[model samples]
Target chain A: EAGVTQSPTHLIKTRGQQATLRCSPISGHTSVYWYQQALGLGLQFLLWYDEGEERNRGNFPPRFSGRQFPNYSSELNVNALELEDSALYLCASNDLGDYGYTFGSGTRLTVV
Target chain B: AQSVTQPDIHITVSEGASLELRCNYSYGATPYLFWYVQSPGQGLQLLLKYFSGDTLVQGIKGFEAEFKRSQSSFNLRKPSVHWSDAAEYFCAVGARSRGYQKVTFGIGTKLQVIP
Candidate 1:
């Protein structure tokens, strides 16, 4: 079985631009989570989506938004990207009410 | 609110030596505890978790953790360290997801293994 999958392993955008990151949860998984890992920093929760609904989000700004598709795939959008937005964005998935999550390799976003 | 703390920022151990990483959590209820490892430039992988039942749980790659309720800690341990074990370790506390609850993570502990 394939684990959570993320696309465009790496991306570069201007500070004022926008970036979209995608994720495909593992088959049978219903919850998708997004986390940001900055250089030399730990993982910070970004958003959580389940059953195509925005379940919860972290302390990020409104500029950081995302949605989950019916099929359990997810898209993370970061608008007005700032230099601090340069970090590795990770996606994880798990079956609703289940245990631990399976994570994707993550997309490294660099804003210049 | 639930939170996790991994006091140690980094640790170094020689191969073939025993290893232990500390984790402490604060929650109103029985918190779901987890240990995850991430290699350099890689994603996080579940090392082990403790929900209920036996306090001791075994994980892949010769990893083990003991959940101490009184101490409010779930520390990760390995009998023998390997070079490949060098990586970043995280301790997280999970709340009642109710479908999706926030899971808080510790700052993380970076492990270094020497030959």
Candidate 2:
């Protein structure tokens, strides 16, 4: 089966602009998660979506938001991007009954 | 809240030498522990996970981790270091939250294998 896939491997946006990243989870997966892997901050949980509902979110500001589509695909939106907002955004999905996740290659967003 | 801690920011060992990476976690109950390896510009790959029943869990790519509930630790170990093993390894913990399970990852420990 195909693993989780992310589009626009690289994205460049100016400060104060908005950016969107997309992810397609593996087949049969229902839970999608977003994480920001900054230079040294590691994987900071951004959002969690299950069954097309936002289940939980991290401590990030409201500018960081995302949604899960009916097909289980997910999109992460970063509004009013700041220089610190530049990082690799990763998407993962699990069966909801499992203990592990399959991650996408991630979208490298660069805010200049 | 669930969290993971990888005390070591980086580690270096000679090829064929043994290796160990420390990880500590905090959670309210028995947590689901996991180890993932991430190559440069690549996504993370699950090395192994400990759900229950066994303290020692074997993972792909010749990796293994032991879960110590008393110490609240799950450390990854490899019998022999391989050059290809040079990468960032993240320790994670998963716990029930908001009617669903949420995972938290550590800052990650970068491994350097030398000849």
Best by lDDT: 2
Q: Which of the CAPRI classes, incorrect, acceptable, medium or high, describes model 2?
A: high
If scored against the real structure, what TM-score would every candidate get? 0.97, 0.97
Please give the C-alpha DockQ score of model 2.
Answer: 0.89
CA lDDT of A53 in candidate 1? 92
lDDT of 1 by residue, A59-109 (tens): 999999999988989999999999999999999999876877788999999
Docking class of 1: medium
Kept native contacts, as fractions per model, are 0.68, 0.91
Candidate 2 residue spans exceeding 4 A from truth: none
Per-residue C-alpha lDDT of model 1 across residues B1-115, encoded as one tens digit per residue: 8989999999999999999999999999998899999998789999998889999999999999999999999999999999999999999999885545568889999999999
Clash statistics: count for each candidate: 0, 0
Consecutive 10-residue window with the lowest summed lDDT within model 2 chain A: A94-103
After superposition, candidate 1 runs with Cα above 4 Å error: B97-99
